[model samples]
Target: MIADTFLIVTLLAAATVRGAAPLVLAALGGLFAERSGVVDIGLEGKMLTAAFAAAATAAVTGSVWIGLVAGIAASVLFALLHGFACVTHQGNQVVSGMALNITVSGLTVVLGYAWFQEGGQTPLLAPGARFGPIELPGAAALASLPVIGPIYREVISGHNLLVYVAAAAVPIVAWLVYRTRFGLRLRAVGESPGAVDTAGVSVSATRYMALVGSGILCGLSGAYLSTAHHASFIRDMSAGKGYLALAALIFGQWRPLPTLGACLLFAFADAVQLRLQGTPLPFVGVVPVQLIQAIPYILTVALLAGVVGRAVAPRAIGVPYVKER
Candidate 1:
């Protein structure tokens, strides 16, 4: 019985990884944009748009890969729109991002209704049209372990290929942000655009590239949420996880590992909330489900309020760079 309890706890821990994947990817996307002096408040919209695109495309073409591409393309277009406003026009980043979010929120439903007439939801796909995991060389071996290994197999082994992509992206992003020349210049532009400009790096170009990278990552995250996790896209399925990712971004101080940790914390809270709905509580005797559902939001609020201090964001963040005339 003790061994059984340990196995169950390990399984929950492992499952938290899957629950955290979307937020991790989205946070990584926000990391690129924010670290490069772009405040992508529209990430929520971008994810929603991508999710809708992925589901619609998959439903029509019966190809998950095409759906993923379509989702990324759509997110890129939206991110470019934000880039045009903030980078080119020197518009207010917050206002521009809010506008984009509102635009996608409305446009997706209208277009989705027009295209598929499914009342803002897309048809579910067959198994082949959805994303699934790959069995790595040693994956089978991992599942056979006594306690911890079984938990990994049950929770992580059957996840979609995008899960691996999302996990791999953390180190890749960290390396790109810290080790590469482009990463150095990207941070320079964010920290001090004037310095970056004096160094002969194209500040505007770097910011645009960062935004585009953000688009691809967020789009991929959204596609995974739709085709890989749920197999169908609900309107506004993102449900503000983009904003949560942004919070994790600030909470982690713009670093990859810390941001992933923050994401896991939130995901764990979410998973606990879901799991609690099934059990009976002593004394309280059946707490309201809404109270349980609010756990993530409550944790987020508490972290933002109590834990965050005077953290300095990138110097050029939210400030449009202007080349000297």
Candidate 2:
């Protein structure tokens, strides 16, 4: 009984981490954008574009690395477009983002049907084209031990490279945001572009850089969705993960570590929902699939309703900087 209980806990923990990986990557990407005073409502669009590009490229090239690059390139292009409109033209950031989202949503489907004719999805990826789980050294040997062994083998090992990248990204982003020179400039620009401008920093440049970083991270998230997590790109594969990531960002007040916590919380809800599907309870019997699926979103709404704390955004977020003569 104890062993069975341990196995269940191990599986749940692993699922939670796997589920949280993409959210962590996307939320951190949003953190960079919002911290630099740009509201990136197009995260969903960029992620979908990247997922399609990555899957299509991998299916054709038979190389997941190449597919990852393609995904990053596609996402970066969208990010740059957002920067061009919002930063260069001084356009309405929200409008530009929504337009991009709508455009990508439709464009990907059209292109998928035109090229692959698989009903708006890329071909199923071959084994070599998708990311495969890597077993850490001694994972086999350590699996026989008690207690810690299951945790290490299941939770700490067996994930693909992107999962590790997502874990590492949190600390790296924290250091970049709080312990680096560019981070200071980025934060200053978000809080007060005028002050950053007065201090000889180009506000536009900083924000654009931040968006680029955002694009790269979002690309990773998308690539993970299609190549690492799923075998192919389906229509609207990103769903609303980008928006959830944004919510996690706001929940964490745009901080990297706290944002990670929020992501884990959502992921836990998701993992539980997956486990609870068709589960019979004392009174409920079998839970409805729709209700099971809605658990994560419901938790998101509850948290945003001030269960955690008040979330204060950057002062200059969504306000384009107009330089003084």
Candidate 3:
């Protein structure tokens, strides 16, 4: 009985890492665009479109890699749409992003049915077509260790390659945003596009590139959702995770490492809820399922409302640049 309890605790801790992957990845992508002076409210749409594309492509080609590529392409297309609207037509950024979200939510369902005839979802794939765990060196042996080590080895260590990529992306993006020439121009444009424009960097081009980069990361996150997490696609599966990611980014002050930590906290809350559902705890009796589900969101609201100070945004964010004659 003691062994079983110990194992359960380890598994739950590992689940926290798995759950954090998507949120961390998506939030990092959002940090990229927003820090560079563009607001990508369409992250939900980008994720949804990528999920559907990945599932459908994987089903057809019997290769998860093809599906991943397709997912990135789909996200890039939608990102471009947002870019065109905000950059060329000078449309409202919030409105444009919301429109994309609604569009993908409906369009994917409609088109999914047209192609698959399965009520808006694609057929499941065979073995070797979907993403599987990577057997890291000594992972299985490490899982036998006591306490936290087992969970880290078994649950967190064997995720798809994308999870590692997502984990690495935070630092890479953080460095790009804070330490590079491109990063400087990106922030400059977001803060004062007039200055960046005067310096001969095309404001529109920088914004467009940022949006496209955001789309690619979002696409990778979405692919991990459908292919790595569940091995299937469902309409509206993103389920406002994108918004939660945005909140995390803001909560972390738009920094990558802190934002990833915030995402993990949210994910850990969710993982703990799931782990506790069937377990018999000592002090806390079986809590209401609804209450458990609300923990992460409650934390998010409380943090935003009570603790976090006012976050600073880019000066030129959401505003189109017009050069003076």
Candidate 4:
């Protein structure tokens, strides 16, 4: 009984980590863009575009690395477009982001159908084309041990490479944001681009750099979704993960570690919902599928409502900087 209980707990924990990986990546990407005063409402669009690009490319090229590169490149292009409108043309940041999102939502479907003709989805990726789970060293040997063995083998091992990447990204992003020179400039630009400009820093340049980082991270998130989590890129595969990530960012007050915690909370809700589907309970009996599906979103709304008031965004976020004469 104890062993069965441990196995179930480990499985749920692993699922929670898997579900949270994409959110963590997307939220971290948003952190960089928002920290530099750019409101990136197009994270969903970028992820979608990247997912389609990665899957299509991998299906054609039979090389996952090449697909990964294509994904990053596509995301970066969209990020640059966002930067161009918001920073260079002095357009409404929100409008620009929404336009990108709307455009990608349609464009990817159209292109997918035109090229693959599989009802707006890329071909199912073969095992070689997908990001396969990697076993940690000694995972097999350690699996026979007691309590710690199951945790290490099931919870710590057997995830695809991007899962580990997402775990590593948190500390790296924290250091980049709080312990680096560029971080100083990023925070400064977000708070007061005028001050940064007065101090001889190029506000446009800093924000652009931040957007590049944002693009790379979003690319990774999208790639993970299609290549690691699912076998192919389906229409609207990103499904609102980008928005959830933004919510997590706000809930964490735009900080790295706190944002990760919020992501894990949402992921836990998601894992529980999956486990509860079709399962009978003492009082609830078999819950409705729709209600079970809504659990994560409901939790998100509740958490955001509670924290939004206390969570303050960067001062100059969404405002385009004007250089003084």
Model 4 Cα shift for residue 88 (angstroms): 0.7
Candidates' C-alpha lDDT: 0.85, 0.91, 0.83, 0.91
- The regions of model 1 sitting more than 4 angstroms off are 1-4, 136-144, 278-310
Deviation from native of the Cα of residue 41 in model 4, angstroms: 1.0
Candidate 1 per-residue C-alpha lDDT over 171-241 given as tens digits, one digit per residue, 9 for 90 to 100: 99999999999899889999999988998899989999999989999999889889998888888889888
* Per-residue accuracy of model 2 over 1-325 as CA lDDT, tens digit each: 8878778778999999999999999999999999999999888988998999999999999999999999999999999999999999899999998998899999999999999999999999998999999899989899888877789899999999999999999999999999999999999999999999998999999999999999999999999999999999999998899888888888788999999998998888778778877778678688776876666566657666866566788999999899877
Over 4 Å off in model 2, which ranges? Answer: 281-307
> Tens-digit lDDT track for model 4 on 246-321?
8888877899999999888878877877887878877868887677656556655665677435667899999999
Tens-place lDDT per residue, model 3, 167-285, is 88988998898899888888888888988888899988988888888899999988988887867788898998888788788777677888888888878777877766766667977
The number of residue pairs in model 4 that clash at the backbone is 0
Worst 10 residues of 3 by lDDT: 303-312
What CA root-mean-square deviation does each model show from the true structure?
2.2, 1.7, 2.2, 1.8
Measure candidate 1: CA RMSD.
2.2
> Would you estimate the TM-scores of all the predictions?
0.92, 0.95, 0.92, 0.95
Model 3 TM-score, all chains together: 0.92
TM-score of 4: 0.95
Backbone clash count for every predicted candidate, in the order shown: 0, 0, 0, 0
